[model samples]
Target: MANDNKDFFERVYQVAELIPQGRVTSYGAIATYLGSSRSARMVGWALNKCSSWHRFIPAHRVVNRKGLLTGKHHFPGGETMKELLENEGVQVEDNQIVNFNEVFWDPSNELL
Candidate 1:
């Protein structure tokens, strides 16, 4: 079980790292790209632990299905996630991304 969880987390990190600046994906999108559509929560869990990684993972580029910064609280500083996205030219307001679909990056489509 531990190995399985670790593998899942590693895959999550890989996908998170692949998220280009100025683009974002949802937890469900990453999970679905990994062939585990039901594991959206697991994707979020893996990203939550990403701070321990040696290299920086763009976990900030991930949001909920509704383009909501649901995991923002997990970041070290308040509004850090929002700041990161805005730095990448993704406008965020009221904790929700503006023009979400325009900035949404789908791994399943891009990686194909």
Candidate 2:
């Protein structure tokens, strides 16, 4: 985690925590929600280290802009990320959400 940007990381966690069960969001959507449209990769960076946090963060709900489980490798087990999503009633195929637009939860639009 970037010590100087702990606040940013915390903000990312905050939004991640709000993602509804069975729904997903993109790192770029979260970054854009935080008024940092260019910080999608930073959002991913923050989520990659969320395991160290004391509280639970639904990092699995955040995927790449294309609805791909690009962060799956960051999860503990081989299929942990996909399993988590599937458990939430979100279908995945070939590491991509089956119904991305239907399950996508855009913070900018939903949190308003």
Candidate 3:
């Protein structure tokens, strides 16, 4: 069970790393890419525990399925994850993505 959890976290980070600098992906997307449609919560748990790796994982580029900045609390600035994303060229409004589909990065090909 421990090893399985570790593997899940590894894959979560792998998916997070694929999120482009100025773009974002949803937890469900990463879960689907990992072959589990119901693992979105697990993905969030993995990211929460691995906040130290934000430099490589781009954890700030992940939002909820509704495009809400649900994970903003994990950002270093505490309450400016959206601002950081904007600085990276991503447009955000009301703590939500303005054009999510336009900036979504598909990791299916890269993950395989």
Model 2 lDDT-worst window of ten: 1-10
In Å, residue 54's CA in model 1 sits off its true spot by 1.8
Can you write out model 2's per-residue Cα lDDT over 9-110, one digit (the tens) per residue?
999999999999999999999999999999999999999989999899999999999999999999988999999999999999999999999999999999
Error of 3 at 52 (Å): 3.6
Instruction: Estimate, for each residue in 1-112, the C-alpha lDDT of model 3 and write its tens digit.
Output: 3999889998889778877789888888899898988999998888887765545667888889888899887767756788878999988888889998888776765556
Q: Report residue 100 deviation for candidate 2 (angstroms).
A: 0.1
Alpha-carbon shift of residue 103 in model 2 (angstroms): 0.3
Q: Which candidate is the best by lDDT?
A: 2
Report the error of model 1 at residue 91, Å.
0.3
Provide the TM-score for each candidate, comma-separated: 0.97, 0.97, 0.86
Rank the candidate models, highest TM-score first: 1, 2, 3
Error of 1 at 64 (Å): 0.3
Return the clash pairs for model 1, or none.
Answer: none
